[model samples]
Target: MTDHVDVLIIGAGLSGIGAAAHLTRELPRTSYVVLEAREVSGGTWDLFRYPGVRSDSDMFTMGYRFRPWRHEEALGSGERILEYLRDTAREYDVERRIRYSHRVIRVSWDSDTSLWTVEADHHGEAVTYTAGLVWSCRGYYDYERGHEPEFAGAEEFAGEIVHPQHWPDDLDWTGRDVVVIGSGATAVTLVPAMAEDAAHVTMLQRSPSYILSLPRRDPFAVRARRWLPAGLAHRVVRWKSILVTAVFYRLSRRRPETVRRMVRKQNVALLPEGYDVETHFTPRYDPWDQRMCFVPNADLFTSLRSGDAEVVTSTIERFDADGVVLTGGRHLHADVIVTATGLTLSPFGGIELEVDGEKVDPASLMTYRALMLGGVPNFVFTIGYTNASWTLKVGLVCEYLVRLLEHMGRHGYAVVEPRLPEGGMATRPLLDFGAGYVRRALDRLPKQGPRVPWVTSTAYGDDVRLLRRGPVADRHLVFTARAPRAPVAAEAAAGR
Candidate 1:
C-alpha cells in the first residue's frame, strides 16, 4: 500500500516549520505532511538542555518574520525559544501535520512517476510514503549524537563527565570544581553559568577564542519596542541590528587588522589591568575566520574577573582518575568534566542517492542557491546565514520557494530539478572558516565557491534582492510535464 501527498517535509524543526507555514498559507490547496524523527518540535532548542543554552545572536533578527520577539533581552534562554517554536507551530496549525517518532531512513526517486519514495520507521513499524516533492530541514546539528573526542582514559575518570548536548537534568554541582573543554560559543556559555554554582570552573581550551561581550538588552530599541507597535518595533530593531552587524562584518572583511586591534583593545579593557591579552584573548586565526563568540549580560568576563573561572590554554592528554592530564604533563583536578567539544553536521545524513539504480554522487551534484539538492525538483532546503540571523536568510528562502511552487503549478510541470549542466566545479564544503563541524565534514560534503547565490555572503540585503528580484534560471534544472500518447491498439489495428 502507498500513501500519497503533494509534499513530504522531513524534520519538524525551525526550517521545517517555517517552510511548511509558507507552503500551507500560499498554496492552501496542496496536500503536505511533516515527518519528525523525534517526538517533539523545536529541534535544537528542545533537544539541548544545558545550563546556559541561549541564542548567541540577538532575537530581534533571529526570530521568525511573522512573530515579533517580546523577550526581556535579545539573547533568550532555551526554554523561551522552545516556547516561541511551540507558539509558532500552534498558530500555524502545523502540529497536526507532524508525524512523530517517524525517522526517515531512505529516499528513492521514482523517475517514471516523478516522485520520491520515502521509507521510515513508525513506532517500530515500517511505513512508506510517496510525494511529488521532498524537503529536508533536519538542520546541521547531528540528530543522532554530538561529536565527542575520544580521549585516552575518558571512561576511567572517576569524576562525572557530560556533554552539553545531553546534559543531565538533575545535576548537583554545588561547590564542585568543573572543567569545560572546547573554545566555541558553548564553552563560553557553560563557563559563566557553571561559575555561579561550581566551586571553581576552569575552562580547559587548547586555543583561545576571540569573545565579544555585549549587554543583554539593546537599550535604545528596548524602549521603542515597548512603546511602539510590534511591526514598527521589529523593523526598527531588525534594521538597527542588521546595519551594525553588516558594518562590522564589512570592516572585518576589508580591514582585518583594524578589527583585530579593536578586539585587543576590548579584551585589554575587559580583563584585569596590565594582564597579558595575548594569553587568554588572542586567537591564531583572523577575526571572524571561525565564528566570533558572543557573551550576554557580560557574564563570561565577569566570571573571569571575579576569579570564579579561569581560562587555561592547554591540551588534554588524557583523563586521570579525578581530572584531566595536560599534554605538558600537568594534572588538573576536576570534580566534573564538561566536554563542550562541537557539533556533527550530516548533509542528508551522508545519504547516497541512486537514480534508476545508478549511483548519484552528491559531491558532483550542484546546489541551487546553497539550498536544493541537484536532480531534485520542487524541493528547497532551508540553510541560513553563516554570519547574520538564521531566520533572516531562511525566511527569504521560504518566500522564494512558495513563489517557485506557484510558478511550477501554473506552468503545469510535473517535475522540476536543478541540473548543473556546466558542471564547472566539484562539490566542496560550503563554509571553511574553520568552524569545527564544517572542517570535520570538509572531505564528504558539497563544495561551494564564491559566486552569486551559490556562495553565501553576510549581506542579507543582497540575498533579499537575489531571492525576490526575478525568477532564477539555470540550465541544469529539467522540467517535465505529462503528455498523452496514442493508444498502441490503434496502430496495430491499422497495420493489420
Candidate 2:
C-alpha cells in the first residue's frame, strides 16, 4: 500500500520532532508525516539506557528555540530528555502524525514527478510512501549497534560485557567492580554514576580526554527565569550561553595554547591536590579538538577523590576472566566491563538514495549550508554542532526549512536543488572534528567546500547569519516549477 504527503520527515527524534513542530507552527497548511524507525520517539535519548546517560552539552541551547526549557538544569538525564521530546511532540499535536516502527530502507527521487518515493520496513512487511520533500533526521550513528573494538580475549571473559548502546536493565553493578573502557563523555559519565552504586569503578583508557566540571544547573538561567518573562528568560539565557560558547570556540581555534593552559588550570584546581591529574585529567589534544567532555558538578572528580573511581591510562593487552590486563602486566579486576569506546557513523541513516534512477553516494556530495546536500533536490539532513550543543544548529535548520517551504509555496516551486558554483571548489571532510568517530568515517561521510553556501562548521552564529540572508531565493539554489504532464491513457480515452 502507498500513502502520500507534502513532506516526509525521517526519524522522530530531536530534529524530526522539532522540524514537525516548526511546520505545524509556521506552515500549518502543509501536510506532513514523521516516520520513526523505532517503536517510539526520542532517538538517542530512547536508545541509550546506560547509567548516567545525559547530554554533554547544556540544555539551554539544546532545547528547542520555540519552547522554553522551564528548568534551570543545564544538563538533562536521558529519561528526562526523552520525556521532553515526547512532551514537545504532544504539545504540537504531532503525536498522531508520527508512524512508528517504520524503518526506511531506501529513498528514490524522480525529477519528472518531482517527488520522493520512500520504501520502509514495518514489522517485516514492506511499506511505501511518497512525498514532495524528504527530510532525514535519522541521526549520525547506528541505533542498533555501537562502535565496539574487538578486544582480544573478549569472549574469554567470564563476567558480563556491556556496551552502552544496549544497556540491559536487569544487569546489577551493586558492590561490583566495573571497568569502563574509553575516556569520552560516555565513559566519564558512567564512571561517576556507577561509582556511587558500585563497590568501585575503573575508567580504562589508552589516553586521556579533557573532561571539565560544569554546574548541573545554571545560576544565571535560574535568576532569569525568576525575574523575566518566560519567553524573555529563555531568549536571554540561550543567547548568553550561545555567545559564551562561540567565544570559547574561537579562542580554542585561534589560541589553542591559551585555552589549553586555562583548561589545565581548571583541572588542577578541581582535582585533589598532588593527585595524578597529568596522567588522568590532562589530555594530549587541545580543547575542542576532540570535543571536550563535561561532568556535572564535578561528579567524576568527587568520585575520583573518594577513591570510588580510578582512571587507568593503559593499553589493553587482553581481557581475562577477572578483568582487563594492561600492556605492562598490570591486571585490573572487573566484575563487569563496559565498552564506552565510541560511535560509528551511519550516513543518511544508512538509507540507500537513488536520484533519477542513479544511485548517489553521500560522500561524493558537498554539504549546502550544513543541512541540504548539493545536487539533491528537496532533501535536508540535519547534523548538529560537534563543539557545542547540537540542538543550536539543528533548531536553526528547522526554522530555515520552514522558511524554504513557505517560500517555495509562494513561488509555486515544485523542487529546489543546490548547484555547485561555476568553478568546482576543493572539498574536505564535511566535519573537521578530530573525534575518533569522525576521523574513522571521514572518507565515508560527505564533503564540504571551503567557501560559503557549501562550507560547514560547528558555528551556530554563522548559521544564524546565513539564515537571515534570505528565503528560498538564493543564487546557488536551482528552483523549478512543476511542469505540465500529459494525462494517462485511461483519462484521455474517457475525455475523448
Which candidate comes out best when scored by TM-score? 2
Q: Each prediction's Cα lDDT score?
A: 0.79, 0.87
* lDDT tens digits, residue span 1-496, model 2: 4677778899999999998899888887777888899998899898889998999988888899898777667998888888889999999978888888999999999988888899999999998887889999988887878899999999999999999998999999999999999999999999989998999999999999987788999999989988999889989999999998899889988998998788788888877889887787777887889988888999988998899998899899999888999998999999999999899988888899999999999999988998888999999999899998988888888888888887887888888999998878999889988999888889888899998878996777777878745455679999999644412222111111
Candidate 1 residues 69-97, lDDT tens each?
Answer: 88868888888988988888878767778
Clashing pairs in 2: none
> How high is each candidate's TM-score?
0.93, 0.96
lDDT of 1 at 347: 76
